[model samples]
Target: MTPTTGRRPLIGVSTYLEAGTRWGVWELPAALLPAGYPRLVQRAGGIAAMLPPDDPAHAAATVARLDGVVIAGGPDVDPSRYGAERDPRTGPPAEARDAWELALIEAALASGTPLLGICRGMQLLNVALGGTLVQHIDGHARTPGTFGHHTVKPVPGTRYEEAVPEETSVPTYHHQAVDRLGRGLLASAYATDGTVEAVELEDPGAGWVLGVQWHPEMGEDTRVMEALLLSARPAPLSPSGV
Candidate 1:
């Protein structure tokens, strides 16, 4: 696989904007992300930047500067996002995050910026593209406060399969999974229970867009991230354009 060349690609990962976070004897609204997200980016030859919930109007402009975007996994997507009623088991709405990340996903898709969505990120991606989700599922996240594992089998001839083209065990932790696929998005991988574990845009011209139900950041494999960094590089200037 090709590493990002010449300069380290700038990778922007969306973060959580919580109501109150306590650290050092003070509690305040904070924008934070799991350390693993940045570590994964750094390990894959890119510069990691944290993207806090910001004005939705600024999303397109913000994405214009980054080489790629990762909508980091977080809270359950508000059921209303895809015109769905809230399931009894659905987690309460994270309205701000939903709006912000949806804008970010739109911007990334519009700009054809390499985008990877993990867990909640993946769910929001589906919503952004006019798809619905399974609000709750079983056995995926059995133990509280701990990560689980499952094998994800990739579809033949998919970009995801090219990255890790086998039935591979992944570090899994999600209660929701993709139900109805989004427009032009293909189910790239699946769990043994037939859960959609991965989805990617069907059109290669749409740039690198992939969402994994499992969190690659929480695992040891770098192939998935490496694929993102590789796609982050800008294409060469042609004789006519240059």
Candidate 2:
């Protein structure tokens, strides 16, 4: 499905905060999101909006106005949220981001809003759904701060399969992976090494909800972003009164 003609869907992309930053006149906290994220949404025919960490209490209200939401990739989720001790390999916890994104996920799930979670976002989604994470996985990332390319196979008859090829190479950079299936969620894609690569909500009636371990925005693939836009569009109105 394609986004509605004329009007572009508004997509909310979560952001991260650099504790301190010095730029020109300002030297304070900064809300940051990768430029690739918004560019990908625009290429897929949707308007992009940045959602910085904010009061969790306002999450639902903020989500109510957006057509779709993307839990952009960033720092590791606080392992304590999932009842796990910090693994030596786990990146430092972004407590503020963890709370904010979790709130957004809760609101999106409750309202049936379309959502796409990437990397850390994917891990947070599993934790939000009463699942656990692998904490750390060696070899998934080739170097300390670079993305590695790998092939992922999508499960047949699933949305992931519909949007992506049976075997597609993706830009991956994550040490944590979904270990247990989340409630009402299914592993829709996997890597050759048997690592879960993507997950989707089991209930078809639920609005589009997908979590991929790879970074689609970092690559040339626009199908995943397009899928989110399709779900974001409003349903066609009936010709006559009910």
Candidate 3:
């Protein structure tokens, strides 16, 4: 397959594998959903491919075939991924989720594939790149509640502002926030409360890699997907044999 063929780009989306029901039956059947992820990708004109936690080796190979990746939002990342103890108030940690996402992040970065990370996906990107998370924002960011809802001011003349309405509101549903930013990531947007709303990889002057702490897939944030897909250049043809 070649990039110039105008084939619809394949976008990989991570899934949340809820093996046990936390609030109800701890031994309940496993469940997985795209969580509106496919819609967002489709809105950007890319074919959606669900990247499950199983068969990660095959999944990584699948990632190589895609033009881009969308690390869809899901359960909280284990704070332990960044050398911290988990907080009780934040609910149970998702170890499997962390493993799957970290592996995918490694594959994507190594391949230099364009990426978009949302919510927990953003948090994972930070941790995977040697950054840290607040774990809980209540005492860290000085918020009224664990969750934050505010307007962010994008850095002027940056892609954040250029991607959507000059001022737009996005849903905030996480307690953890990026603390020590990862290498190659630059804070791109922030809440009036001073919490980070989004970040971009350094040298995006070379390519696009973005992470946002919001749920843009639900509704009214269509532009968010548009911005990410537009950032991906057509992929190069398969080299030589493979």
Candidate 4:
């Protein structure tokens, strides 16, 4: 369903390109993302726009027009980004995507635009902020290419805790975890094994910035997305009703 009235906050969701995809009498590289990403944004009262990987030079200009940004989950980030050798468990590098999304992250942060990073997106955010990654972890994923359900507990009195007041089950599919806290970021939630499941900007004045190691778009919980929408909302009128 489309919004018939009012201004819907424009949300930019990063996407990947599947090279050499064939479909419906066309064969070419295809920019792609799971439909759930857009659907979730729309359901949360935002106008979702897919952002295909592009020249890093244009990232600032691209984000300037968006009210919010979401770095959707995908391939593992290149280990070289964090100054580590690639682990055998790490997926092949999608260097173009890395460059593009890293640029977007920087732009979003610099502009103070509300941003949400999911799975690999969360890792990328850390890398962009001078943090390192675990590279690989066992028992996080139940199987290859599949998601598992797990309970995540939020740190008390945090924005993440405010968004999710209680422990919640979330769909997770990742083998890497944050190994160090990013600059000006705090771990806001954790898994039973003490894996960092969620993080947010440490400074309350940094604007809205949150990252999750799980796929919220793939789950039924709308609170996380709702929080983003709240941040995207226009400020209310003054007491005199300006």
Candidate 5:
């Protein structure tokens, strides 16, 4: 479907705010998003926009204009957000990004905007919902810098299953995993070692929300992104309601 009732949705993908980035001759603080993130959105028929960390208070306003939102993968979320001590193995906190993205998640949920979270995005989703993290895990990202691969089996009848029904290998790269699921969220998929690889709304009527531990933008799977775009599409008016 072309989503004519709504036009192609404009999906905002969150980005990383890093210090001391250089390309040619200018080295300064930068808001960066991996090329893969925007490419995935474009490939799935949605216009991609890079959203850098801004005043947390502006998140609601930002989301109100976007058709959908994507929380991109990034550094470890500050443990303090979930009332936990920082694990030694956890990466240093990107406090600004954490605060900003959490606000975005809240805005998306409150406004019923379709949302998709990948990798670190998933971890933040858990924390945003009053859940905790394992902090450290093995095997999922065996190698340090490169992405590993893992097959995940979806829980039957879940939205994750609806999009990817069969067991499938995904580009995996993360050290922390969701431990206690957030309120109103359910583990929709698991890894071979029983890690929570994907999560979604328990009842799933509060707009579209999905978080995957894997990096979908790094691989060939368009199903996940496609589903988000689908949710952004509004049903045509029928005079009876609109």
Candidate 6:
């Protein structure tokens, strides 16, 4: 059932690798999930394409065709990437995941395709573009009773301020955060913990490209998600007056 007028934007989603094996046997099995991202995008009128981490050298062509790229949340990024030690509780990163995401990032920036990053995705975006990460939140601020949960005031003259409301709360579940923003990227929002909650590549005249530390797709606020996707959609042609 193909639509006649318009097509849903093809949003490419990156995947995480997980493996499990039987206790008494030697069979290694692996499974993949849509990472709860496709559902989010679907709600915004876009199709999600689950892409596994692949060789960056060969993935540019594949990414060139997508309307947007979403770097979904996952386990902590490799500590080596930020010149820090890995927390034992944090799982090891998927090398393939790292490579493929970088490829997508490069492609998105080059083609000016809409790009969005969530949680770990935001951290990855920072590193991929010659930026650094904080490695842990405690290192940056004092820990009160509550976790990192609060609304951020957007910069007065930024694109995000215009799109998002004056204040909004989002669920937060990351220890690492952006320390030194990547080149061309601007800090858009922040969390109560003083950690960066969001960042985006600013362009007065271009498509959308933003990253958030929280997971709006899995939370109560859908406006942020809506703003991103809606901005990505091509502006409709003016109807001729009869």
lDDT tens digits, residue span 120-206, model 1? 988899989999999889888667768889999999999999999889999988899899999999999999999999999999888
lDDT tens string, model 6, 150-182?
676676677677677576776666667788888
User: Per-residue lDDT tens digits of candidate 5, residues 1-242?
Assistant: 23545457789999998899998999999999989999998888888999999999999999988989999998988889899998899889898999999999999999999999998999999999999999898766666779888899999989999999999999988889999999999999999899999999987788899999999999998999999999885444566744
Most lDDT-accurate candidate: 5
Displacement of the residue 36 alpha carbon in candidate 3, Å: 2.0
After superposition, the stretches of candidate 2 with alpha carbons farther than 4 Å from their true spots are 1-4, 234-242
**Prediction-by-prediction clash tally:** 0, 0, 0, 0, 0, 0
Better of 5 and 6 by lDDT: 5
Cα displacement (angstroms), candidate 1, residue 208, comes to 0.8
Error of 5 at 172 (Å): 0.7
Worst 10 residues of 6 by lDDT: 139-148
Candidate 1 lDDT = 0.90
Q: How good is model 2 by TM-score?
A: 0.94
TM-score of predicted model 6? 0.81
Candidate 5: segments with Cα more than 4 A from true spot = 1-6, 234-242
Candidate 2, residue 6: CA error in Å?
3.0
lDDT of 1 at 47: 87
lDDT of 3: 0.75
- After superposition, candidate 4 runs with Cα above 4 Å error: 1-5, 234-242
RMSD of each: 3.3, 3.3, 5.2, 3.7, 3.3, 5.7
